[model samples]
Target: MQKINKINQYLLENYPSIWNTRLVWMLLLGIAIHIIFFFIGFVSHGSPSTLQHTRAIDDYFSTGLVFVHIIISVLLIVGWLIFMFKNNAFKNFYPGSRNKLFLEFLQYFIIVFVSTTFYFSYMTGFRLFINYKYDDETMAKNVDIINRSVPFLSQNIEDYTLENRLSPKPFVDFYCETDINKIDKTKKYFVYHDRVYQYFRLYPKTVKQTDERGQFIYPEEEKKNKTALAYFENNNDDKSRTYYFKQQVEDLSQYIKTAAPSYYNYSAVFYDNANNPSTDIRKYRYENDINNLNNKEIYKQKQIVINRETIRILEKKSSKELEKLMEDFLAVSRDFDIANNLNARDWSAMVYHPDTFEVRSFIKLYQTKPNEIYDPNKAPEGRYGDYTKTVVVDSAAVSSDNYLNENGEIMQDTISARDFNPNLDREVSPKDYFKNNISGFYYYTSDLETFLGNVDTIKTDDFFWDAVHLYIWIAFALSVFIFSFRVTDLRSLLFSVISAGVIILAVTLFCVAVAFTFGFKGTFFILYTILVVGLLILLMPFITAGRFPKVVSSVFMIISMMAFPLFIWLIFGIVNEHQVAGCRSQVYVSDTYLNCRGVLDDFGLKISYAMIMFTFVFLYLYTGFIRKWKALPE
Candidate 1:
């Protein structure tokens, strides 16, 4: 404590101007105020678990604390700037020789450097502590919640899936049947599956056959074949008959391949018997076997192939088959594609019975008009299960109020993938829908809002407030430059400001050129160039002593000093732009919501860059000052 007092006494007595500078007072006071706020929060919040105080104070009380911090910071800066003007500390220092000039510059540089160093160190230290506290508190809370819930949720687990309409308990059952019998035969069967949905709409499953006059239908055998024959005869004049022929060809090929492999073998054997009997006998030991190839399968395959080939031949012979067919089809029915284009919206939900250890599942499917996923008039035509009991999985869950209008149709503003569809009768597992959503029974929570609402809200005001704190120091530095004119005269002040502007402009243009030429590589080079140029400017005064040279030297000094605060801010802006862009592009994950988690890391990196630049500038000034002082004649 005595050593600290001696050092303080030394600075106060020997470097009175430096000791009295606003820069020093502001930093010292700002840091003291921050420490007070930290202590207040630690006490009021009870230890640290309840202290959600981030770098940007979360609680109302913390915000008030920050307000006080800002007020003190402003007062310190304003009060010190006033003191500099009143005391004429700016004119107190002057050098008789090169050595003395260097010594004077060194003294001023140390004051500014130490002030800046202390200011940043305190700000960053306070922020780091707050951030760590928040992280630790969040972890503790989550761990406690998990610890309490784990044992209760671990028992009687059954894999509930929407695909099979399976329930965790045997007593719970689904009403919907996915089986694909004909709509008429099943009384009530939904064509929810893609294969069945497309098939029934596109092609007639039970095509009716007619006699010569086309007056009466016949209950005939080979129903599809007979129907195809009748359709061909009736539409022989119309070129659209080719569609039927083409469809027949496809059906025949598939049927022959899938239904009658034995017939294919029989045909191969017949050809070999007639053309290469010796080779055939060598290849097949089943030549005399009774079950070698069945007659019934051979006959069935032959008839199908013959019928299809005949239709295919007729189709090829028809002129402009596709064009005429399309025209005729359109002419007959303009809405031919309407049914095929039905909008299919699927929704899945899981219902957990915490009391009975049963999880009821529901998959609501809506086959609606084209582009109509939600219909207000109809409330998903009475499904077999309890629709009210259904609940969305974590990923699929969203408030209906966000999407649905007063009339129950999708609102204009809230039409997105997350919007709930009222025409919806589907429930797909959140896991199945997102594939990336959380899995396991342990992840389920009865209150989704409660689970998710605890997330920290991103208050952009916090960042701006933090930035304001930084800019206050920048304002102080700039004020020093402007106020330095009181001692140096208006001419020097004008020259410094103009020269600084020109230098910055030149540097900016050069950076642009380099960036264009070499891309990021060039920008990196420019950054190094800035470092070199900054050092050169700091040392330039030691090399010359003319009035113009003095003016130029003073200009560069002020510009370099002023640029320090802005340079750090510029680096921050660039990093911030990059981080925001990155976070915007990225999909949200559990640990992050809109880049909130990276705030501390981002700020830390900026501070680090600032520290590096400041250190380089300091070293160059200090080295030049000492060298000149040592070289002076005693």
Candidate 2:
């Protein structure tokens, strides 16, 4: 019994060679490494991460990637378990070699590939999913995604009209409604857009069904055009159109999102593939007789039914009667909802009257009362937070809402930028946008708002840094493959292992440098493929370091470098545009920002060029092949 007990103890102690080796440890270590990189990417990327914090931490993290990470983690653990339990796994993985040290180092390479493949799956899957703008279930439908979403080419600016829905209500925080209680009736009011004369409708006490030019831009259409259209929005303003983003990208972050509520302006939003019945609400587009006010009569609703008999138009020719009508109209409307169904007059500006229909604010046309021109001296200040200074830009001189007294004298109710001039302030104004109109300046705020996010490279890292992460893993993978063939002679074995390592790192490092110059794009995969092919081509020709077949290796490496570039050129040429390329969005964004990621264009060529230079240097340094090919026998 004593003999058997000692024998059992000895077997147990010697069987497991390394205490650190355990299925749990393998999984833990692999998972830890992945997590480390993921976190680094998250930080460098500066986007929200699902794993960095617990559920309680909501301020900065996105829950979007959490479940996917959990699934990946579980899969990795399973893979580790499979590797640990299968006895034959070693037979296929770890092989003997003449150089014990090389063999030992190679073992680590083996594990990384198996583990990496498992970890790499998450990225691959996510990228594939990204090809779809929204989840399978929630892609925008009925409401066709504004032409920018699909196809290699899209519509031009002229194709769009005042009614084009390419841009939804994209900004929320900036617009605010003015108090109607203070009206400078005689002074022509100006809206940023709709540069037209305002003829007040007597019956509705609002802007007549149409304006002087017959352009039917009502409340919402006018505001959107002022902010997003014109020279700034379309580059039509001067020589540039993509306002703020295209022209005034002073602070990229500020443009990231106008505010939290309006993400579509900045953020690339997507829903879960399984999300049922997408949240798109384009079905309830309102229709009323507001399209043609000249012919249509108003609807009088009682007990949830319309009574057309009550739709008589009371014509008040005098100013007092008009004033009473205006008062009645103002008091009646809390919001304007229905618009452009029939005519401008058909639109209703309800005063908290939820039943007639909810219009936030509709047109209000009144008879023009002759008033003094705007006096910058009277209204010294504006309600906006501060007078913002501009750069050397061609901006229009802007005035704030006028400050008037009860007697209608131009009083200092508000202030004007006392020293504002386009040359001095360099900021565009509503007047600049609405060059044609100063008539009743229409202003109102709407909940039709948007949120935005900037598509930017994580500030903490650049393409070079991103390349380094891959280098380490690649190094590990190459070392494993080279060291696995441990049956060769010591000189040859050492030569092969070192040669493989140098080639792997050379190609990768060269790629790193080239990628930084060009852009990350597909350089990594290109270099990786080249390195792989180069190794395969060189393997048979250069069996050992002593027998270094310099020409074979050089030829192989050259081919490897050229292959990636040739493929890149072929792809770009065939596609006819950048759309088909990988992560071209990054390239597009970079082009906007001093062409920061411009390196993507020539990365493949740069890599090939680098290899040529390397070849020349290598040939000059290594003049002749090793005279006595084989190293001394180990």
lDDT of 2 by residue, 419-488 (tens): 2122324433333422222233221111000000111111111333334345444534343333323223
Off by over 4 Å in 1: 1-32, 43-68, 95-356, 360-491, 503-544, 547-549, 561-634
Cα lDDT tens digits, model 1, 448-529, are: 1111222222211243345544544544454455434533556767887788778779888888887777765543466566
What TM-score fits each model?
Answer: 0.36, 0.26
Error of 1 at 254 (Å): 39
Q: Name the TM-score of candidate 2.
A: 0.26
What is the total number of backbone clashes in candidate 2? 65
Model 1, residue 560: distance off in Å is 3.9
RMSD (Cα, Å) for all candidates, in order, is 26.0, 20.5
lDDT value, residue 57 of candidate 1: 36
Cα displacement (angstroms), candidate 1, residue 516, comes to: 13
Among these predictions, the greatest TM-score belongs to: 1
